[model samples]
Target: MTTPLEGLATIVGPGNMLTDPTDMAPYLIEERGLYRSSAQAVVRPGSTAEVAAVVQICAEAKIAMVPQGGRTGLCGGAVPAGLDRAIVIATERMDRIRVLDPVDFTMTVEAGCVLASLQAAADEAGCLFPLSLAAEGSCRIGGNIATNAGGTNVLRYGSTRDLVLGLEIVLPDGRVWNGLKSLRKDNTGYALNQLFIGSEGTLGIVTAAVLKLYPRPTERQTALIGLPDSQAALTLLGQARRASGDAVTACELMSRLALDLAVRHIPGLRDPLGTPSPWVLLLELSSSRPGGLREALESVLSQALEDGTAQDAVLAESGTQRQALWRLRESIPEAQKHEGGSIKHDISVSTSRVPELIERASAAVADALPGARPVAFGHIGDGNIHFNVSQPEGADKNAFLDEWPRLNRVVHDIVMGMGGSISAEHGIGRLKAAELARIKPDLDIELMRRIKTAFDPDGLMNPGAVLIP
Candidate 1:
């Protein structure tokens, strides 16, 4: 007698399917290590047709399926939830760049293509694919689209949802929906590609995508400015945008604590400013045209300082220095892990209200757990902040982690009060599903459920992910 997964193996070929637990370990673990997934096997389908065949086998058996891409998501969206049997449909074997049309300014790529590779392909074509993130080298385009990922560049270029033109998805009942059109102005009917873009794999599996491209920036300027506080940082962002003619490509914020942790943990990474302030803004300006970017950025900083919005600043004179400055910004998460356990919130508010959200949330967390250090940092230009709290010195890791729920509520309530989103950039995977239900309007959630039902009536696509059953 053979197992049900053995049928799936026949479709993907024996070499592409893994039944041994050791062989499947990598696919079964979430990036944060907060959740461990249990699956009957991990299937690697090589193409859209192969993916459809595998889905058909699983659907016939009524076995749940989780669509995985690179598995670098912080939300645990790709990890299987329950003890019930399931299989992970890994897209690694489907990695390919199917089309690159510089004339149309678009690239059609398989879902498993790594983000960094896609950017490189666009660069080679004298274009730019601007959806960047810390996990670009490991995260796949499919996952980025699934979560509607936003990064530093979101202030200018927008999120993955904005970058995508169309997508190819395998439906719940093994039907393939190829909506991969590269046209920019298609208004024929309902924009169906969007339905799966941020659905977190609950609706269907994204197999490929047609992504929009942009003219590559030829001139660039980066600066690190020290601010009195988050309020000052917000003000400086306005100044930078106005002074630079709205050419600011990135504006990231970091608390003094966040900077200190990065400096201590990451070697060769040092604070560019001689003296530290309560908050710092890592601002970058870019243009396709050459010259004057440095001068424009300098003028912005001069005005910010003269107006008392900035206390001190350091403009990167060389590419090496600019990279060093970015390293300090990107290394905060790894640094926090080294310090102790951390409770994190990826929340976003209106740009004007960021200061209040940070100030009140920090005070609230500190009052609840004395000595808890808040490391607030991220894309301030777009109002998404990675507000994280490190454990107090000498506290038990597990004990500190157990306070995740209480701490989350303290932060989320303040976010909701400010008309902000609790899960910004990161999708509401299993972690935030309950919080989403509690906070979201009943009618809004009901509409979402109806859409989910229409797409996946059997609910086999990534069960127990974004929606609670």
Candidate 2:
């Protein structure tokens, strides 16, 4: 019987196969250093043809194939698990910008195209691809679509799924399903791309995609507003939307604890407003029409302050200053890493339930584990909050981690009770597969399993992810 490594080389060529464990070290582990699995080999396929060939070889050999993108994924989606003989199908080498149509306002790019490069290509053509994330500089568009990434701009532009016009998927059985369509409207059959948007590489591998584009904003306004709490932030978001109409692009909320960590840990970063408040709301408005955006933001902010909803606020006077204000908001996640080990809960509820969700989750966590610090923050405009808990001061790291499962149960229970999702923006990779199985309705699980079996009956694509055995 031929070895899995040798079988992969036969399809993708020996040059693309890495069998030595030392050279495969990086691909064996995940970004967060949480889960590690040994791969028999790592294959760097250069084209969709190569990917299909590799998949066919693996399926014939009864070996598992893990589809990997930029490796910046927070979930263990790209990470291998279980004792199955596996090979990672790395897509980085397939990077290419296939087509850019300024007239039709669309761009067709390969799965491995870096997210930042795609954004730059759109901007050069005087269009905007607004799926902005801090990891955009390193993350690939394939992983973004696979995870259905949600970032700050989601308030105005929606998630990656919203911007995707079409996709090219490689099925588990090594069949290349070329479903790439760039049209704006297609009243055809069911939208197949939607199935793979947040599938986490469970059903198929995304090889290329057709992405939508929008008119580039000519005028922009940004503000740093001080509010008393989450309740005030919600009120401010409503007021800003009322004032700016459709130009309200971003409304991000940051807690005082979040800001403190940014200042204490991250260098060259300070409060944007120069004064500390319990909470801050970063607001932005963009328009195709030039001028008056700053005035419009100021007018809305003035009303907030008069209503005692805002203590103070500042507007960016220039492009450089605008980026500076954004830098503070973007630095929160990185700055948080320096603090210590943390338990993260990316969840969302109805827009009206923001304040209640924060209050209930915080109280429950504190009650469950005494002295656990809540570092809750994120896109309040979209009803998603990263409800994180910092370990108690000087506590045993492993001991704190030991409580993770129970802690997750407490938090997730409250989330479900309130009619909220356990996993919001981030896809459920290996981390939450079991929890997902336990909590989701049986019919839902049965349907998902049926679909998985239909597309991947042999189960060659990212097995042990998004499903329980």
Name the candidate that leads on TM-score.
1
User: Candidate 2, after superposition: displacement of residue 145 in Å?
Assistant: 1.0
Which residue runs of candidate 1 sit more than 4 Å off their true CA positions? Answer: 1-3
Backbone collisions counted per model:
0, 0
Candidate 2 has an lDDT of 0.86
Residue-level lDDT of model 1, residues 84-195, one tens digit each, is 8789999998889999999999999999999999999999988999999999999999999999999989999999999999899999999999999998899998999888
**What TM-score, to 2 decimals, does candidate 1 have?**
0.98
Could you tell me how far off, in angstroms, the CA of residue 60 lies in candidate 1 after the best superposition? 0.9
Q: lDDT of all the models against the reference?
A: 0.91, 0.86
For residue 228, give model 1's deviation from the true position in Å. Answer: 1.0
Tens-digit lDDT string for candidate 2 (169-248): 99998899988999888988888889999998989999999999999999999888888777998887777777777688
RMSD of each: 1.1, 1.4
Q: How far does residue 125 in candidate 1 sit from its true spot (Å)? A: 1.1
Q: List the residue pairs that clash in candidate 2.
A: none
